[model samples]
Target: MTTLGHKSSMDHHLTGMSDNTVERPGERAPLVLNMDKFSQVTATVCRVSEAERAPIAWYICFTLSLGLLSVLGVCIGYLFLTGVGVWGLNNPVMWAYDITNFVFWVGIGHAGTLISAILFLFRQKWRTGINRFAEAMTIFAVICAGTFPGIHVGRVWFAYWLFPIPNQMEMWPQFRSPLLWDVFAVSTYFTVSLLFWYTGMVPDLATLRDRAKGKLQQLGYGLFALGWRGSNRHWHRYERAYLILAALSTPLVLSVHSVVSFDFATSQLPGWHTTIFPPYFVAGAIFSGFAMVVTLAVPARELFGLKDLITLRHLDNMNKVILATGCMVGYAYSMEFFIAWYSGAMYEKFAFMNRAFGQYWWAYLIMVSCNVITPQLFWFKKLRTSIPIMFVLSIIVNVGMWFERFVIIVSSLANDFLPTSWDSFTPTWVDIGTMVGAFGLFFTLFLLFCRYLPMIAMAEVKAVMPQADPHGAGAGKHGHAHH
Candidate 1:
């Protein structure tokens, strides 16, 4: 009787039930809204995957994605037949769209590990709503990012030599280059992220397996489920593995981008040679990453009728992150100029000046306006919460970030010490097609994932709801207690 009374009172407080009750200023709004029952959460998420046919929008988007993917394939085939000369590789501008796109996509993958591992460690319950697909985005983005370096090497057949392996020829990868560091860092990051993503999906996969009506569905989901029975022992192991992976992934979120920064920082080039690149790259990465999340989230929530699950609050919070990181990136931009001037080095000062007013000044201007100026609009609550505004702003943020890379790489390389050899770089049609094709690849995988997989981490979402409390009102009613 006492326990029941206690549970009822706690439930009342959690639910904000009393007419006179006022929400405290610091109290977080509910992460999941509407459809109070645990079963409702399960049914809503499952319906997207279980539907006999996806909505017409899915077909239209998928068709477009497939077309882009075909474009990517043709471009790659042409490039293999032709050469790296097919790109706009000029005298001084060897690294143009290829490196820029590589870094952009790698940065795009950062938000997943951040949302999943870092937020989970901090006990941020809101992460449960979006982390699943963010992780999927990470994997796909990495796949796109990885494509560049492989093909950029020119000798695609000899790409395997990038790895350290024994052979009759005794060829070994250069140990000193930061480029090699990227090989290890990105590959390790991908492996761990894949494991983390799959581990989180096990219980949810088991759910799909049990809910399967067809034999093939059962077998496919069951194969991946790995005998998840929801037993306490199974959960115990599951949680331990998850926590460990989260811990592992947190460092990776910091390390992967830092290593990527090393690609430029280790160089002797004036603008590229700076200590600030690590943190700057990481911040810009998270900034652009969250923007991509917003870009995808806005469409996803609306298309799938997930407005209640992925509420305005979620979008609002992500915009705030975008705003914060945008400030960091802006600060980094100013600091680069400050460092260049403060160092009393003519070459460094010239490098910074050239970026602002040099041949590629237009690119630099776009980078600053899009990356630094655009996100400031989020400071206003009304603007940040507006769906259409945030969507457009999110896309703009990515465009700015891409230009950020372009400005950093192309500007520095184009204006290297000897002005006599400097030449303007103009990308060929293959370059534009290849970059667009990478987008196609990313969306193709993502669309398929949404169609077949549990787009939400169903078990994780249930764990955060009020009814997950063992002593709550809904406890024991429908076996909704989180395992």
Candidate 2:
């Protein structure tokens, strides 16, 4: 039957009215391709990771990322030998690039859980194609996020003091401090996200294990597969556990960024002390996270030659999400200014003004243009559908998000109430190197993931294809096996 006929039949079935049209069994709209057989879907996605040799581009990118990792090491070594004085941080602007990069990376981690958990609960089957990689990105981004705070404590050896573990000093973390709350919140977020990512990959690993060509491949994939046999009983328990994890992660997506905001909201700094920080930071987190996903996925689909699995429809959907969250972030930006002016608090008003017209107006412009204006183009269907445009905009969004943190951190601190203590901040080479190194760390892990693990979840993608629906009209009627 034609696609239109199937739609009409579906409408008729829902309305329970006889339309005099022939309703055929196994008829449904194709989500990705016209002939999406299970075998083909599995072959296409799994082929990338299981190939005898990875693409040359993978080696090139991995090499570059490794160099960045090395740069991060050198900068960190310098930091240990010298001190925080190597950076431009001083006086009122003590919290500068380090905290900004920390928050930026944490925000980048938010989209993975949002896509994996919230969308799964809503039964958005489209998420099945991208959630695996996005979850991987989340884990990597969180790792990058955690690095800054650990190093920022100034004494790496004493970092264990942040935890509640018993130490030779017999000192416990200050439970009342929000900073300590951050330690707990971030660690919990990391732990749960890791579990969620690993659980979802097991079935896919089993698929890889079955397809392995070499004994070593079989052994490695088999080790991670945990003897998954794809039995009905295994699937039943897996589904239940997956549902429970999704439910748990939904709130963590919201709470993690909110708690990160609390690190500032609980403070008395002029720009930081605001009730709107929680929701504002959450929206911004999702906004930046989706942008990063697009940035990674656009190039990824092309490089891996998995365009069919990660189709233009998927890209368009992600762009629409970026647009929505971008608007939310823009609304928050305006609201901050409005509330600042309306409250008649001179300090709040001054803080906002300094952010716009003060010494760091250039950073403010980049933040506004990238975060607010750039995403506006996605409102046009043509633009969002265009891969080149989406890729460029995605990068722009990431850069804008980093500057947003910079503006918030540096601008607020540089112009505090006591002008005598206030001083403008400038980042030293160590600051720039550390931030670049964080990117290295993130991409290095991501590259390793792409090479070793399934970059796309084959089984989940198969589960979402047209043939997966046992009751759909096209299921058994087509030359495809019913699940």
Among the numbered candidates, top lDDT falls to 1
- Each prediction's RMSD to truth: 3.3, 5.2
lDDT of 1 by residue, 327-419 (tens): 999999999999999999999999999999999999999999999999999999889889899999999999999999999999999998888
Q: Give the alpha carbon lDDT tens digit for every residue of 176-287 in model 2.
A: 8889889998999999999999999998899899999889989999999999999999899999999999999999889999999999999999999999999999999999
User: lDDT at 335 for candidate 1?
Assistant: 98
lDDT of each: 0.90, 0.87
**How does model 2 score by TM-score?**
0.93
The alpha-carbon lDDT assigned to residue 152 of candidate 2 equals 86
Cα RMSD of predicted structure 2? 5.2
Q: Write down the worst ten-residue block by lDDT for model 2.
A: 14-23
